[model samples]
Target chain A: MTMDLLDDLNRAIIAALQENPSRTNKDIGKKLRVSEPTVATRIRALEDAKVLRVMMQSDMRAMGRPLLALVDINVEGRPPEDVATELAALDACTSVSIPMSNPDIFCNVNAVDGEDLQRFVDDHLSKIEGIVSYEISTALEVVKLDPRFGKLRGE
Target chain B: MRLDEVDREIVALLKEDARISNRETARRLGISDTLVRKRLRRLSESGLAKITAVTDYVAMGHTTTALVRVVSAPKVAREVVEEMAKFEQISFAALTTGRFNIVLLLSARSRREVADIIHKHLRSWSGVHMVETLELVETVKHRLDVALVVRDK
Candidate 1:
């Protein structure tokens, strides 16, 4: 796939989807004053190029999995990337990233309750051989979570 | 926001295909198109569910995305967060319990741009004592749902 530059119409369509992903291609074309086929073609191209993806995101708290914690793992005698990949294989691990600074690996995990969390740490997380120490930070509240693909031009 | 069986089915269908037509959703669930539309509208309006376009930062010309951890005095954590929210480069920001008061997900075209955000825009806050930037190598899995598969009844 070629590196296609995001044009104005593409940006407009993305902005519209960001507001309501369920909007039909015809509806978006009408709103943006573009042809329906053009809108459809652009949407397909964006998705194919990995630039745009539409997915359902259910609130974890609403789903009864309220415990969201960010764990910054300090790798002891092994490479951080391997440790991160190992953690990513776990079912409860939602996100795992190998950071190039501060802590070696940063992961976000969710649990249903305190006991579940304890089992996760003792049984799963700590048992990973290379992990020396980890700092667990519970997300108190989200100030902002703008999952937009990029700036929508003119902010 | 309790999701009924129909709601769960709608969610499961949408999770598989966000662009699925309401008529198709209704057909699959053996319900009327209007009910599917109504339920989707209610779910989105209540913030119980969201359908949005998520991009791969690297694929979008953004070479670097960093998780910046900010340490600020407890009294000024809110003030510090308010300042960080104004920058469009920072996508996710939250106050957490740990060594850092706020963690922000920032993406930029290059390392220099990321640096400018941290130095010029972010670190200028008087209340911010220390700012640590962690470059994200790869995201193994990132999703807002607990899991997409609907439980069998």
Candidate 2:
């Protein structure tokens, strides 16, 4: 949290985790010339300060399902709180949010398998009272996605 | 990264295969080696991108994956996110604006495990307004599974 805490070793640890949130603290420390305990402590401190979050990175393609659905919903006059409440109830709606200003809501629904996706459309998102229309940009390709947080250090 | 046509193409290639050498990428893009090196430095300096080898969960013997949506009192969202992160397959959680307050991208060894996690863990929490989930039926391209369309000069 302090500027002085942002050392090269810490930055390296952050970078390694940014690439793979599932990596071990030992591995991160090995790369950064710090002890495992030190890495663990720093990571704890970082997490406590709300600086870093971790997640396992899974390759969805290994599953036999087809299509990475990028469902963008265009909304108007819908209270965001109300819309969020309804959208989160659907099965296929994995990630639902408003990323940009133009469109009020954006949902990342992963429909790799199951009838749940269609059911989700019928049950959750469409049922939302304020939703006007939505578009599905089925991922032609997933170009890039990486962790947004990093350790900030002055050059 | 202030990517010109050439740099975007290079990034697209790297996104697909991070192992490509500078010389190889330069030759393939018909750009000089110096230009390739210079551009790569600029991209890194700008904090615009990063490249890393991703993992496949199925290869590791895990079987089921699901995304769980959570809505709760504002005070408890962080608590929920923390609880989700402690799980092995609950890999990604984001606080977003929409119909849902918090969404988690999770994985598990079996369908039953997902059920157990939700029933035993999530279902009991207080201030939790709703719990809805969708199991991943298939995965085509993961987080970085596609190439960004690059314009050619």
Candidate 3:
């Protein structure tokens, strides 16, 4: 099997799984119109390539981490990726991104409360070397969280 | 809403593999299959947890991903977000503080496609005052498998 065909099949398999994560390998193969073994091998390949993963996400309110904030950090001396990696190691961080825009690193964190979040900023984030400035934007409400990439363009 | 140790364990296992069988989960937790099923159903019913398949947008032919920061009038921030939410391409939307009133996550086939979406839908909105786009280089880490710790009463 060529790498191009495998990539396409993997994408299709991912799309199918995104629609329904609980489907078994056999069920997924049936839906994708591929042999079961082929599906299994392709899935294993994707998994090995780190292109696919199954994850469970809990509602923040239900889990007691009601305070979700997006932090934009500006680094003066060090590389943004290094700072991002440092920030990513924090337990509160959920997502980290290095964008080609203002504030070098963008991070999303789920904190226990306002005070906890403040302390995390003052103590943890502020102490990171080369971080020139940082801004925290508290989320009033997360209107949408998870998005279906396959159905993104209404296709 | 309080979760017991068993419930947390169940969530952790599901985080590892959403498709793990009840028997396998039961064996790992040293519990009965029936109990595992009941707990899972309760968790789902209570809206505490959900297992879903998600893909990296870049992997799905979406070569470009941008985080748009919209500055809206304080009075119209909520309204602008509502309008933004109507578009299906937006993966994440949040009402926020600081310089931007709302942040939107957009993924598309190319840089041009992202610009088209912004011009066609975003700028047209009356409430939008300023719009800034942050093109993401990479998602260094996205951790969804959070471990739940039971709180004391």
Candidate 4:
């Protein structure tokens, strides 16, 4: 659906839930001044359209994967898609993307500590054939991480 | 908090369907509803886990999503990132050690807004040395299964 079709009410409902995902349909309706069924229907439609998803997320630090390394890989002999698929299959790899710019592959990897991260690079990443060169950036601190991408207006 | 087997099971169920009722979770796991509720409360209260909504930015009309790597002057990367984090368009920001001192993931309504953020705000920052943006073409994988990454305690 286009941006114009999202309408104010739909955006409001999305914003409310993005702020607090646990909010019930009845509570959302009360806050948005709509009926409970309306809120439910809107949410269902959004979900059906693959526009929104609600799921459980955990803090990486709290979950024991305290180290996050952002890796950029340049591919040569093989398709970047194949390399990305291999990277995504690794247990530590959380996200993998092909970029429009340089650096053929980009991925987010989690490890328990520095040692684990190094071992992963040495054991798993080193085995990938197409990767000509790669850069690993260890995140020192996560300044801000708001997962509510739907709340475009900024809270 | 270290999650035991039961806790992992509960989390796994929630990962599949965050809106599942407590009773349904208990039934599926063959555990008491009260136990499910208590574990969920503990998980949430401890700040370890949460049920939240996420969206496909492109589907939500955010046509531009890019990963920006920023190099900042000595002893100023953290400060620069702190300021960048306040922008509404930036969803993720971090200080790092490597080719770039800072990395950010931002979604914008258009490419112009992305350019505005890079040139107007990031370039204008006193400490920012250089900015390299890699616009995402396709997301091969995006999974948030904490259970997959959780370590044994």
For all candidates in order, the CA lDDT equals: 0.77, 0.58, 0.77, 0.81
Residues A35-152 of candidate 2: C-alpha lDDT, one tens digit per residue: 9999889876655544444422223432234455656576768676467656656544555554424355656676764465576577766777888887654543332223232221
Whose TM-score is greatest here?
Answer: 4
Structural similarity to truth (TM-score) of each candidate: 0.85, 0.46, 0.85, 0.88
Docking class of 1: acceptable
Per model, the share of native interface contacts recovered reads 0.71, 0.01, 0.67, 0.74
- What are the per-residue Cα lDDT tens digits for candidate 3 across B1-153? 578999999988887567678999999999999999999888877767777765545455676878999998788887777777767677778888788889998877889988998998888877788999999877777665542222123
By TM-score, the better pick of 1 and 3 is 1
Q: Sorted by TM-score, highest first, which candidate order results?
A: 4, 1, 3, 2
**Deviating ranges (above 4 Å) for candidate 1:** A4-12, A19-23, A30-33, A149-155, B144-153
Interface RMSD for candidate 1 relative to the native interface = 6.1
DockQ of 3: 0.48
Candidates 1 and 4 compared: the better one by lDDT is 4
Model 1 chain B: which ten-residue window has the lowest total lDDT?
B144-153
The CA lDDT at B82 in model 4 is: 78
Clashing pairs in 4: none
Question: Model 2's CAPRI class?
Answer: incorrect
Chain B TM for prediction 3: 0.84
Better of 3 and 4 by DockQ: 4
